[model samples]
Target: MKLQTLALFCAVSLLLFSGCGGISPKPSDETKIDKTLPIVKLTQNGVVEDMNSIAFEWNAITDERVKGIYVYKQRNNLEGSELRHYKTLENRFTTHFLDNDVIPNTSYTYSFKTFSKNAESQMSEMKIVSSLPVLQSVVWIKSIENMPRAAKIIWRPHANQKVKSYIIERKTLEEESWKRIATIDGRLNAEYIDTGLKDDYVYKYRVKVVTFDNITSTPSEIVQVVTKPLPNPVKHIVATTDLPRKIEINWEKSEAKDFARYHLYRSTSSNGSYELIAKLYNPTFTDIVEEDAKEYFYRVSVVEKNGLESIHNKISIQGITLMKPQTPSLLEAKLVNNKIEINWKNKDSRVVKYSVVKKSKTGWFDAKEEEFVDIKGLKFTDPEIGPNTTYYYKVYAIDAYGIKSKPSIEVQVKTPAGVRDNSKKEEITQDKPSRPVNKEVEVIVPTQDFN
Candidate 1:
């Protein structure tokens, strides 16, 4: 009996020691969700009414074995695919999400996953979860003008996400807030048309999650827009030039990246308002003034691509048409009959003007500038010559820029004993008109002549 008791005691000792092999087991009271928020139970709250106020609901808990819960989102269908592991917090119940800031015209599929600090519980039935958030579509706030209450907001379904609805919101820029605008149907949709707006006011727009609960998650980033009528722009301005038969216009070229064509303006007077002369595809423009006005002013303006024009730039200059003079060496005439006929001719008129003057015993006085002064045709005749008297004559030419030259050698003539002079008459050999005998003038803006 002593041996038997001894054997039984040894067996019990072995059994007790085998049972107490490793470390102590952790208690079940404490819960910890670490890397993932496991989907122990998924609850779908059904379809939403107002897309703007739509929302998704879920219940959460960190496994009792984990230290903290790590929340993650699977952008694709919440299938057992990959998840963009995002936020992690100690608490685990905040599983609701708002579909804001998503690209317009696209859908987003969202799902929740739970991670345990124990690492033994794999991604908790993410694919197996019965409930998930189906973001119908994201909408872009349409820009509006001249209406406070009414607006036209638009959006698109999330491309890569599974969308089931759309939500939009609006508020005045002055209010510093937003209100629900319209609820877009996910199945039957294109654009959300909101009408009946105030006359002139500012408005802000945003979007929200569209699900069962009106639990609007968070406001979308506001798309700023304005609604006011545009003011009128100044009218057309004209361009003209100082040179006869010439046009010149100047304008400021816009540094705007969206630059467009330019316009030229013309006006009869410097002070007078201008009129649009023509449209130039370039910044600077030139046109011929056919009428050859005595004076002209010009204006240039910028034209935007959107058909908007800026104020005109104005400038004016004096206009003159100059005819150069010729050099006449021998000029003489005397009274032959009751008619006082006179004749004159010149050398070259290299872009110059000529003035002819006469005197009655006293020295010469100023006379009128001539039109027939060029080297091409330098002759003029006043066909009324009267009888017997002495006449003195001299001539010279001026340049294109209106610089007068010195007088030519003078000649004295007498028409006496009229009938006998017929035998001694000399043939009038007219030379191809010669150019002006120019004096070397110092040029202010000198240029080198190749010749």
Candidate 2:
């Protein structure tokens, strides 16, 4: 009976040992793998490369147990794109990745997860990203003047971070190759002015952008601009003041299709202020100024149809008005000692000379010889007339400009029949006269002082 109790105790002890071996020990919290994803920092924002390529970057993960990284992307409905897994990275130290397969005008969402030795962490925060749209063509290019010789080029700016500078290029219709005109920073000016250009020319322009990574963008749309032909200036302006109180201005017309009208300017002095006096379609203008014996200035300019005015060509002239010398009167003719003598009353002291003309009784008026005397004397003697012959005499006065005055009343006289030519008489003639005769003499001769 003692041997049986021992066997049962042994069997109970063995069963207890077996049940203890079947039970498992609980694990400690220190050995458990984390299920949360690593918090990431954006190292670089989403940026465009080339035209359609994109690149993104982030901070490295800090978890000691992180074995690999998984990058996931989704197409955002806001961007009109589809959702899909973009990439899975086996390297946990990788901080950046490139997305070459990107469409323009489409948006994307990115998320990353960390995988430990036992478990996968939760996905990190989703990152919204997109590439910039392609560079578009220019909208329009034009000139500001009606007769254009310069152009202004304009374009829209790109909104991407990679864009650094803009390049402007041009090609004229006469040239075969393209030429770069300007390069501007995208952060500053957006428009360009091309001046000193030829008129009536056709030009084409284009633009491009450069990124920080030294990548060039596609060229913008081409714009074609045609310039208008410039009009020529008015030529040969002349001013004349020949009338009593009027000034006449004349200029050659500009033979241009864009010729609209003309403008006339007047000034008292050559270098003084000028005022607009008249607007005319014709090239000739007559100004009725009341002032006399004064100098006047004038200018003329042509206006184009586009409102551009040509350069002014100016002219100046002086006008004068002087009184004429008075006529002489009281003409008388008489016969003395077979010679004829003629006299006239000198009423005008300004008269420089006097003229005497005589004709036979039945002779035509054209067959008469005229004699002249200076201010020295008012009387003349003729000895070549035959005695008892009928003759007629007249007198006139002359001015400085060789203008003649009215004639005096005609007188008739008769000479004695015994008279001969003056050359035959010895007493009335001298070999050499005291002063030059029958010519213009400007000497101050001795005269009887009436005072």
| Index of the highest-lDDT prediction | 2
lDDT for predicted candidate 1 compared with the true structure: 0.45
Best by TM-score: 2
TM for every model, in the order presented, reads 0.33, 0.37
What is the RMSD of candidate 1? 18.9
Model 2 lDDT vs. the true structure? 0.64
- The global C-alpha lDDT for each of the candidates, from Candidate 1 onward, is 0.45, 0.64
Off by over 4 Å in 1: 1-153, 156-222, 226-242, 251-254, 270-273, 291-293, 313-351, 355-384, 387-451
Candidate 1 is scored at a TM of: 0.33
lDDT of 2 by residue, 1-451 (tens): 9999999999999999999976433222344446564755566554444345667677888777776766677767755555444566666787777877766666778776666666666666787777666654333433333235667776666666677898888898778988999888863446777776677688788877877755566777777767666567677777774454577878887787778899888888777787899999999988876554446787777788776676574443333333345666644555554455565676776677777666765334434544544434577665666645666766777766555566776667655445554533543321122332353222212143211
Summed backbone clashes in each candidate are: 55, 3
What are the RMSD figures for all models against the true structure? Answer: 18.9, 22.2
